[model samples]
Target: MSIEQRDQLVYVDNGAGDEPLSTREMNPLFSSVLEARLARRQVLKGSAGAAALGFFGLGLAGCNSDSDNDDAGDAPAADLLGFSAVAVSTADEIVVPEGYSYQVIIPWGTPILGSFPSFSVNNTGNDQAEQVGSHHDGMHFYPINDSSEDGLLVLNHEYVEPRLMHASAQGVSLSSGATPPLVGGLRPADEVRKEMNAHGVSVVRIVKGANNQWSVQPDSMNRRITALTPMEIHGPVRGSDFVKTLYSPNGTMTRGTLNNCGNGYTPWGTYMAAEENWAGYFTNKGDNPREHSRYGVPSGTGRWAWELADNGADEYIRFDASIKAADATGDYRNEPVCFGWMVEIDPFDPSSNPKKRTSMGRFGHEGVVFAPAEEGKPVVCYSGDDSRFEYIYKFVTAANYNAATANGSMLDEGILYVAKFNDDGTGEWMPLVYGENGLIEANGFTSQADVLVNTRLAADFMGATPMDRPEWGAVDPANGDVYFTLTNNTRRNDSNLNEANPRAANNHGHIIRWKEDGEQAATTFTWDIFLFAGDAGESGVENNKGSDPNGNDLTAENILSSPDGLWIDPDSRVWIQMDSGWDDPFGNCAMLVADPTTGDLKRFLVGPIDQEITGITMTPDQKTLFINVQHPGEGTSGDQFAGGSYSSTWPDNTPSTRPPRSATVVVWKNDGGVVGS
Candidate 1:
């Protein structure tokens, strides 16, 4: 597939439509660093070769060291990753190592609750509320009583493609991500409702049978949290005027969580869903507030035009945040403010209402990753704003973490900090407080709530570093080193290139890792590049990329791009998943494993055509691994859709006419040994 074809696939799943380039007027810190690197390259050009320059350390050494604490879990045996690398593939199927096998489970529209309705293209809106959602992204597997055989699998549904969801769009010549043609300038109410129902999270109980295959089971814990579910508001922004609306006059509650992309699990066992690209779900035509404008809320209509539902119900109409009433409380003008938050849910408690944590500093959240919890220590976590030239944020709770009583309330009161990476390999965490760092009433920040509601604007005022589309974040449990994936930033040019983000027009992204000076709550840290993702043959500082420990170009066994979903296993093996649109040298989205200590990377699995490989998790014993395949066949064009065909029919190879369905695949070694062994 070509890059254009891959762009179409991305459009179908990306909630934010064609994200605008960052127009913030912050200083470019990387230009000097880039110049220094170039000068050093000239000095050592002949003697050491380019490879030596590629692997030279900036200021830090021993990028990955074995931890003495072993806080994550028991460290795996030596030679942690021993599996043979797989080759790049474009076949419409899951490809794993020779000894590994996989089984597909809980596909989109799979009935898990209510009357157990079977999946059908014509399923009612109500039926969709009870079924598994589409476009699975970030996920977690919570073991019941620490048993790897049975557990609750929780995952996020990032967005939905209408052409694949409704039978009414069968013969429609709609482009990818485009909604079906409107009937008399209004969409059918039920179709709109079903689309909303498919954008959220799913909590289902799955168990391993005698055959070693995981299957969904009938349990009270099984539930679906969609875009219409009632939820509570918590944290600094809660009960503030910024979030007050007709539906939530008290500002203590809101309805639904949308565009849930990356996710996290609290030390207390609660699940945190990051709301990404949620701004596109609402539109403000009258006058735009800074909150809406900074977050990229459209002025015309929502991405799906939910506000134009023919039924004209209040819930459906709230998508349009126009000034219909005089005050914010009397209209949905504040409805857009109620979103763009990290929603916390208690997966084990079916009756509990999910809470939108306002203290996390609302933006386009890719995901949240918590440091290893230490008793009596302040709880700390990090999140990245998944947008071009956005800043990364960290939150430290005012209260100490106690495993026995730690809950979502700990997130209610905290200090939100934006990162500022300096040119000298050191970085500081700038607090986004109301009265500090020029964030006072004179600067339009009246209170803490006001500062948080306009997090991006405040970060801009505080001079936070503009990153290259920061995506999923992961913390190494053994050493507390933080890692973040700066997926491709095509907008980056020579004028803004820095040592941290070295590439100009970075087509293939890189991974950045940092270690706090002393404690997890430290204000400063030393950082370095973990690896640069690119094609196997490309080799140069400007266009090609290199790996860490040994600066060498990627090999056929390990080439990847758009590193989105990331995870560090208990043994410190770095698992990276791709969400790439560049499929020329790299065939399809794949999952690769890297030995953090040696920086030895290898491809573990490759996914089907036109799909993003994301949302990975494994059982406690490392025997059962689960990964999501999102929007398989997403590259299908208007002609293919009109002809009743698709680019892929994964997980359901039978019935060639069946549309592709996003799903979770369970993988394990046939010999029942540890995965990736």
Candidate 2:
């Protein structure tokens, strides 16, 4: 495919993007550091950022904290760069700001290596080894040197496009949203096989070509991890009966990592590919744990009825969570527990198997981000449980970080703490340890492993504040200030409104940020709303009534809704990406950038109809920026083959010819200058 042509790949994230329809603990610090720590705590606890601060009895000073503050995490003082902001548009093509430009680098089926199988217009499942995974989500670039020309572009394939995956469309069944039982039978085995290979993560070596263009090189380093690959079960929950199955009786190993969504990197140079909405992939008939049902695991046929395949092969049948044998060890009853984790992959070494770090506590992990790494201090990771009313968590390592000793071991011994935001604008991290809290033998906890296995249950017992759908998170590269995207929560109402989630029916979504009390590893912190999504005319409950930590409020010129993907670039600027159905009238989901120092926000790019602007990262030199366009026509209700009702035909902008595909987009400055310049 030419650089001008658009393309897409597929994966399994259970990604809700435009689909339609459908931690921590703290310890007592030594006296030497106590004064500074307390002082820092006071600044966060007492400082006022948003007008919401005064809603609490603890109260804010007459002046906003942004005006009186001495913190780098505060809102920007002014727009540092004078780049023009792109205007909102309903155009079916990608529209970028005037000075910025973009091209499609690796489309859905671009051949990676010469020897690998080529992508066919037939959309056949035969080229599994050679093609890229589907539905690209979170991504990051690992530079091989100081220059940004070459690096391993590691990205996540969040989910698959079943209708688009099969060589031929299932026009009748797909049009009305009928599947398996509803449509009379299971999908073709070939289709299932194609989807199985289209999930997990992809590590491709991309290099800048002679014409200032970039291309993916199918080197030995290029690899695609799918749903059936072998993986080790590591950390607190490893070797427990909760994970034992027919494949891994000892509870030490499992096969594959699917539905891998949000992406992250360790200071030690590794990749974290998280799994979200994995529970629904299985069909649990026998008496299952309550967590399964709470997570939306179906009782009969699942989203896809792979179990109905009559091949009598254990490999495909294992996806069924039902019991088949006499005992737990004899069947796959525990398979559901093996998923819903953040798997750590060593990208530099292709031979190494990825490990699921259970110590981080598994529960609908949207993304896991680390605080700025300090050689001797403990490393902290923040994550969000991405369901409505779910809670946020952070993990604190027991061992300090050292470049030499930092392997996956540090993540193996961390305490998972859930957040509880008080109306007073202060929040505490409640430890999710089994014995220490209400999780005990009488309540079904026998070891620490149980706590990790049932992390959601543990958080529920500890009274972690439920939040809007917390999706992606990023920490400022320069400081420990952290930010998270609370993607719209359709179910929120006045009955459940809280100080942190100020809105009743929060459809537009918002972003929340906090500065760690001392460092990333601190146990307690204060937080406030950074920006709320809606029209500038909005006021009261549905609007962001207050200003950012720097007291900067959002205006209608750049109003947004459903902020999903978020990133902090090397330049320390914040990039907010949007995801939602085409029905939303605010505008097509787009990507926006901001200078935290000046609180200047502007549209960088906008995507096609029924598509989400997600997965963002930048090259080392900050000249090249990468973004993903997912499920261009997710809300199409009927068959495109007959009525031609499919919502989009992207990358291949032709009308009524090619199927829509999810893809990665490369954005660069027209003058080869820094991205927002």
Candidate 3:
């Protein structure tokens, strides 16, 4: 089918709680994940608790549904179904399809170190390292070898949910025995401490079974790296005053990687996990009136106001911009300078300290895509900004490869560039080096430090094109074409639409593609809109123009709206994951597989109510699939609580007095063969 013709066959289901683009900023559904974490880590540099307070329970009516198709119930399970689908959206249960089973080998607060005792949900002996942390996000499975029996699972702990992760959920009240009120914002210090330690990555070993199953090996190399963990800094920007702090004492050392999201692994055998939205964790008191003006901290909002929590813990104090010291030497006025770079972890050795590769040029990095490895060639990477109207970026490591040196720290030296997409279907990679490219040009930028600390502003100054809401990205090994999820952008309405993001009220998002010239990731490339998303009925509409894939013209066989997670399987099959299906009549999120070579996309699996389909990975043998179910029943409250009142009593629902928890799941076929083969 032609690309345009294929687009006509698909449709985006918009049902309940589907708000306008502007309304999404305050959408309470999953805002806590963004507001509670991003504001404190990405935008602010201290006291995430206080910064998140300003956004407390700004409920925008959460919940969504998908459209129903008569064929949905009887449709043949896509060839991928030999492998069962597992649900990890809730903590109380781990659900897998019939014939296939799963167990919680590792759960939040599951003690890792022998020094600490097993976890008790009541927070009795929750040792941060020994116990599994909260809200698992992106993850990877490094199979041992072609015939090896086991591998390592390196997972990213995105953030903590105070209510579920700690003994007493913070920012919650006991009175009325109802859901916590949004008014008295800011979680307590203990809650913040638990969250801080929960922000890094975890590495655990897994073994296969005779029945084609997997389980965690407790003494099998399980380890945790928390917020307090010390790490090394590398690349041109390493140890530059931009990273030094009272905590590091050596400008070169930094503590932990926060808000780690989707990840990348090197052909040379290292793990690259991007630290995203990590700027909001610090507190810069609005005291400097001057500093506040420059960084865009709202004056009356009392930026980082929670830094004043009782006893004023040091961890909490770091977020405070109101430094008592007169100079940078004594006070942490410059604390916000430490985060937002891609952190490299050596999953093989638990003793290895993670390294922050600064050449990646800090931003709200959604994902980093590494080009296939080649000797004597530059390492190329593509990244995106999650915020609306933000920019997309790329990086080219200066150090050339030598297959012999493949795993020998490829990130040590590299150059970072921001993408500039042109209206004429072409684009260039603009180098963002220190003292170069008018980077020092003001918007309050005094030096390179300012440029890195405030990367979004830097990209803006460089004239980078703002994308629709770039999320996870994937590079096709078969064709070298890059595919990124723009998700949905409501702001691209009549007043703001452009060739790159050419749609208004874009509920369903499209995928953009670019093929590098002469096989060089550093070279200028040609670009085009790969697909448009909307209901079949909305074809030919303005915002939907150039989007309908099967319209007997240009936009055929395109995808529907709200494209969130994306991954390109080794076979060149493009897997698409969704999150905003609540508005659909179908009543859930879904997973779809697309053939970029043919522009043929088909729905593979759909999730249960109120859950986002995220984090898809495959075992090295390509025989197993692992997926993550995040916030399945996000809106459940005490008043609405019941056996089924919960958005979903997922996995295997049973009688349990436990709050819903997010988790990771493994799925494999009943027979030991290539999955989806």
Clash totals in order: 1, 27, 71
TM-score of 2: 0.87
Candidate 2 vs 3: which has more lDDT: 2
| TM-scores, all models, native as reference | 0.94, 0.87, 0.78
Stretches of candidate 3 exceeding 4 Å from the true structure: 1-107, 115-119, 124-126, 145-148, 170-189, 287-311, 407-409, 440-450, 538-560, 641-645, 652-655
Candidate 1 segments whose C-alpha is farther than 4 A from its true place? 1-32, 39-62, 67-77, 538-542, 655-657
Per-residue C-alpha lDDT of model 3 across residues 245-341, encoded as one tens digit per residue: 6676557777777767777777677777777655444444446433232233322212223344445666566666555775555656655555667
| Cand. 2 Cα-lDDT | 0.72
Q: At residue 537, give the lDDT of candidate 3.
A: 44
lDDT of each: 0.83, 0.72, 0.58
True lDDT of residue 156, candidate 1: 99
What's the true lDDT of residue 346 in model 1?
A: 97
TM-score quality measure for candidate 1: 0.94
- Per-residue lDDT over 256-298 for candidate 2, one digit per residue giving the tens place of the 0 to 100 score: 8877778889999899998886776777887766646555566
User: Highest TM-score, which number?
Assistant: 1
Per-residue lDDT, model 1, residue 335, is 94
